[model samples]
Structure formats: C-alpha cells, structure tokens
Target: MDTSSTPRSAVVLGAGIAGLAMARVLHDFFDAVVLVEPHPLPADDRPRGGVPQAHHIHGLTARGLDLMEELFPGLDRELEDAGTPRLDHGRDVLTCFPTGNAPRVDTDLGSRLSSRALMEARIRGRVLALPNVEPRTGLRVTGLVTDAARSAVRAVATDDGGTVPGDLVVDTTGRFSRLPRRLADAGFPTPPTRTIDAGVGYASGLFEAPDQSWLALIQPTVCPDRTRGAYIGKLEGSRWMVTLVGACGDHPPADQEGFRAFADRLDNPVVAAFLAEARPVSPLHRYVRTENHRTDYHRMPAWPDRFLVAGDAVCAFNPLYGQGIGVALEQALLLRSLLAARTGRSTPSGPVGVAGVAELTGLAREFQRRLPRTTGYAWRMSTFQDAIWARHRAGRTTRRDRAVTWYLDRLYRAAAADPATAATFARVFQRAAPPTALLGPRVLLRILRGG
Candidate 1:
C-alpha cells in the first residue's frame, strides 16, 4: 500500500445530482476529489443520457432546498433569478386528495420549481468551481480497485485503462447502479435489498402553458380504490411539466394522445383542464421505476473500510413521494457529520497528502451503519403509502406495516380539511418533522372529527 498517495482524497461515482452534491461535501474535507461519470456532462442545462428520468418531473422538497442552500449558500435566490419559480407550498400548491381538496394553510415552506437538468447544472457549476475538485466525465467505471486484503477500496478502475485513486471511495450512482455487483465479484458480501413496488408507471410531457393560479398540482394514487395520480408543476420558461401516474399495473401511456387522455382519468380534473389548454412542447416520456428500494448496506455483516455509498444507491424512494433529493442531501450531511466526528483524535497519515485521511480508516463503515437514521423516515413515508396501493409487493411485510399505513391514510383524509392537521402533515411530508409528529392529540382530534 502506497501511504504517500491521497491520504485525504475521495473518488465519487456518477456525477448526477447525488454525485455532484456528494462531491460538494467531500471537497471540503479532502484535498483531491475526483468525480467519475460514465456519461458526458453537457455544459448547457440539458438532460444527460445518464438520467433517463430527467425527462419527467423531478421534485425537491423545502427541506431539500434548504439543504442545498446550506451547501451552496444563496442557491435559492440564484435558482429564482434564473426564472425558476419559488413556490409557497400553502399558497402555490393544490392537492386533490381522493376524498377532497386540501385546505390551503399558508406557511413559510417553499421550494423552487425547476427541471432536474436545471438543478443539476446549477449545482454542477458550483461544485466544479472548487479548486480541489475534478470532474472526470465520459470515463467508464469498471469496478472498485480494492486493497490487497480486499478490506478497502483504494481507487476506481476505469475501462479507459486508468485508475482514480483516493483514500475514500464513494458511490452515488442512483438506483440502477452496478457497484454492488462489482463489489460482489471482488469478494465483498453483497448487501441485501428491500423493495416495495406499487406496479406504478408514469408518462410525462412538457407544455407551454399560460401563467396559472397555482405553481403545482398533485393528485396522488391512494389505497382501497384510487389508482391514478397526477403532478404538474410550473418550470422555467413558462413550461409546465406534467407527469401522470397509475398504480396496480395501471401504467400511463407514453404516446402524446394517450398521455393527454390519461390525465382525464385522474381524481383531479384540473390536470386535464390544464393539458387541454396548454400547448405541447416536448415528446411524451415514459418511466416505470418507481419502486421504494433500499440496499441494506448498513445491515451488512462485513463492510470494507474507506468506502461508502449514498443517495439513491443506498435508498431510492417512490418518486411520487418526492423524497429522493431530500433524502440524498440528508445522507450527504450525514457523511459530513461522520467525517467531522473523526477529525479529533486523528493525526495526518501521510506528509503532503489529503487532509484528515487518517480518519478515513473506519469512517466508511460507521457512516454506512448510521445511514438508516436519516433514511428510515423517508423510506417508510413512501413505502407505507405504497403498501396501501402497491400491486406488486417486493418482500413480506408484517401486520404492523399495514396498521401504520391505515393510520396514515386517516391522517391524509383529515388533513384534507383541517388546516392544523394539514400543516403538521405538510411538515412531515417536507422532511421538516418526523412521522411520529403527526400522532399528537391535536392531529388525532382532527382525524376523529373528520371521521
């Protein structure tokens, strides 16, 4: 082992939102950070081939936006200045629950309405500006280059006949990542995965719509009866991004006519009305990977040192719940915290090398083990809702799972009309509060009244 090389360095895979955001955190603690991506990242704000779901609506909760602002300060104003609409949830969002419309409860919670492309570009610009960070795009990641003992990954092997070495190797390669397979081949125990799929599919289209009263509209698929959901948000350039979703194998159509026709079947007719008046601007795009799955890396009995996985690579929630970005950013923060925790009682491992590289010895596994603390709330929020609606179940769930989901359904129904209840529900949805926060007596009173 070459102790002189990159004692405080990190190699991050996949430069999408997750990878890019992870790079932002890594650069602050490490000396040299290499961002490896298989696809060519365009300079302009356009969708890259790597993210197929880019064509669909990618949402960020208020908590996620706040996290981004924390990393890249003033990002909120920057996004707004670029024509991204800053939507006040209570005033700008209209949700049509299966039962009725949710009463608008004005609050300070708001987030920018922008395409994934736009958000990625903005974050990329800031991250790439860092002097210690290097963006290596169009490079193929073949596998993890491990130490002689196979106990730690020291670098990333690329098909270009080159390797990017770092003290710590991180994977943020989204849901379809092959890192686990590569690791399994390298003799590490493949972590078990838990999934909850609702047999859901989506068809999305971009339209040039007139200025509307609201910034976003949502009609989610629910249990027992409802199978359709819709979300249409005002993006930059006066373009509205519309995504129609269906559960229980009731997939939405990909064709333009079918896309428009499917909207008419939603619980909320507002989506249909908007579609009828708006002019289509892009080809209809279809996506079906909406399962809530988590690779239980934390629970893995044996984990290598100096290697970590974050973002969707660890846990991908149902996009319908809009938990991906927030959870990803939270995970990055967790990484930062874990790194900071080890800063004390650690000395330099090598001269003229990466800073804090000595602490990297055991931080990777510690970070992985603590990740559930951040992901559990978001994972349950999405999967529990899907339990009521998912047609294709991934694994066996206990009776308590069903019981918890039913209680959530009641809370949603009560939130439809009760402002106080809705506010608390919104807090939980935005990642501002935990799900248990809704179990308060006030929320219970509202639910009983609605019943």
Candidate 2:
C-alpha cells in the first residue's frame, strides 16, 4: 500500500455515497481508481434505477455534513450556492411528538437540507472530477475475479465479459450487495447475516409551498403511540420534499389525496396545513425496503485478501433514523485514516485525524473489525426504537434494550421542554456526539427531574 511508486490500483463497486467516498480515498493512496456502477447515471439530479431511495427525503446529519465538507473542500459552500437550504436543526426544524411539539430555539446542530439526489449528484460530480479516478457507469458487476490460489480478488468481472484488474477491490453495493455470493463462489469465508425489518414504508412527493414559519416539519414515529411520521422540507430550487412514513404496514399512499390524508392523520396540524395549500410538483414515490440489516463481516473467521466491504453493505440501518449517510461518511473517514496510515502519509489531506493508526492490524481486516466501534452506536440508536413496535421485533430484545427504550422515552419527553436536554438529544441523535452525551450529568439530571 506504499504511495511511493507502488502503482497501486483499486476498483470500487457501486456509485453510492460509500463508493464515491471510497474512490476519493483510494485516489490518495492508489495510482488509479475505477468506480463502477450498474445503473446509467444521468448528468442531472434524477432518480436512477439502482437507488430506490433517491426520490425520498434525505437529510445530512450535522457531523455527516461536516465530514462531507472535509472530504470535498468547499462542498458546503457549493451546496449552498446550488440552492441547498442550510438550516440549524434546533431552530429551523419544528419537531413534534405524540405529547406535543418541542420548542425551536438556537442550538449547534445544523444541516444542508437537500434532496438525496442533489447531494449525490454533487458528491459524485466532485469525485468523478478527480484526474486519477475513472467512472464505469452502466457497467454491471457480475462477480469478482480471484487470484490463482483463490486467496484474494484480482479483478472484477463485468456483464460484458470483461475484467478490470486492481490491487484492491471494495464493495459499497449497499444492502443488496452480491459480494457475499461472490466471496463464497471464490471459496472464501462469507459472514453470517442478521436483519431487523420493521416493515416501514415511505411515500414522498415534491411540492412548492410558501411556508416561512420553519424550514422543515418533522413528526417522529414513537411506536405503540405514534406509528405515522411526516418530514416536510424545502430542498434546492425552493421545492418542498415531503416524505410520509408509516410502520407495521401503515404505509402512506402514493397519491395526492392519500398523501394529504396521511399527513392530516398526524398529530400535528402544521404538516397537513402546509401541504393543503402547496402545489404538487411531482407524483408520489413509495419505498418499502427500510430494514436494519447487519452482515457480521468483522466476526468472519476468515476474510479474503485484497477485498473488503464498507457502508450499507456491512451495516445498513433503517432509513427513518437518517444514520445511513452519517455512518457512510464515518466509514469514509475511517478508510482515509487506515489508508493514510498504511501508506505512511504524514498528514491526511482532510480535516479528519488519523488517531488510531498504530493499533490497526492490516488495512482490510482492521477496517471491518474497528468499524463497529463507531457504527454500533448508530445501529442501536436506529434499531432500538423500531424494536418496540409489535411488528418490528425481529432481533433479540433484552432487558437492557427495554431499559434503554424506557430512558429514551423519558428523554424524548424531556426534550419537549428543556432546551439543554433538547440540544443534547439533537446532538446525540445527529451523530455529532456520542450516546454518552445523553447520560451526562446535566442532561441525566434534567431527564430524571422530568423536564
């Protein structure tokens, strides 16, 4: 992995956020990087055949936004100039719950509230703009070409009966990645899998509404009490991206009338009132694959050399939690750190620091094992709430999880009244801070005191 005259090459699968970030990182360490995707990517920000969630609402967490800015310098300004609305979550987003609405005041958490398509388009555009990076759009990845001893991935097989050789191959194909089967076919060890499907479905639409009260409206789904949720936000172009979510078969209908009806069913009247007057700009799009899937690659007894997995392919969370992008960004930063360390780069180009480089095993193996240290919290933050829904009980529900949920309920209720508690809640849930932030003395005291 030496950056000096090693002439390393990398082939990254998928064109999603993970793949884009990985390609950017590989460009730093490798002499050449090839980014491959099966779908025909359009120049504009339109939904493609591969990504089903492109049409839905997607928010960048405060930390994810910061990481993206680091990965692609001046991206924040670029997004803002592109009409992506930047808003402080504490004040710009009016959050509601079954009990009531939380007070919107000044706090630290903020995001560039753009549609997923727009963000992806911007990131992919910047990534592909790199001189050393090559793009293979519309080329399907059929399988992996293994070495003679079948110990490592030597190249990637495409649908056109061609192979793209590389020193390293990365899988960022998200939840539906075929890397496992490809590994098994190569006589390599494939990891065990676990999934927690909440049966959550989404119906989203675009609208043009003049609601200056707040930049976004969020009514969260707190199971057993609230099964329906609404996220209405204005993305670039002054157009509103309204996404309605329902758990346990309570899906939102993909029609104008039904979309409005679902919004009206929410406890908050703000969501319905805004949509009631908005002009529909697009038809509703429904997405139903919101399961929490965990592929235990870190625990795999044996892993192939020169091959690795990252992003949703390893740990895909429920989309409702908005942790997918944040986790991917984290994984991207981690990749940079491990790569920079392995290559003996004195300083990483980004703002992210390589703090734990000396303790790593190999780059490929250590990436998978150490990832859970950061990703596990996001996974728990997402899946814990969904586990309580009578229909979402797929994983083991221990007494600890029940206790965590109980405390989270209290924290949610407290967040409704106390600004400090709400800010902590926002930071923790935003992935800007750790879960320990919720258990801090002041926040813990506020939660215990019944804010």
* Residue 317 displacement (Å), model 1: 1.0
Predicted structure 1: clash tally: 1
User: How many clashes (backbone N, Cα, C below 3 Å) per candidate?
Assistant: 1, 0
lDDT of 1 by residue, 127-165 (tens): 888888888888988888888898888888899999998
In order of appearance, the predictions have TM-scores of 0.92, 0.91
In model 1, which range of ten residues has the least summed lDDT?
A: 345-354
Runs in model 1 deviating more than 4 A are 1-7, 344-353, 391-410
For each candidate in turn, give its C-alpha RMSD to the true structure in angstroms: 3.1, 3.8
Off by over 4 Å in 2: 1-6, 348-361, 390-406, 441-451
lDDT of 2 by residue, 158-192 (tens): 99999888777889999888878988877878789
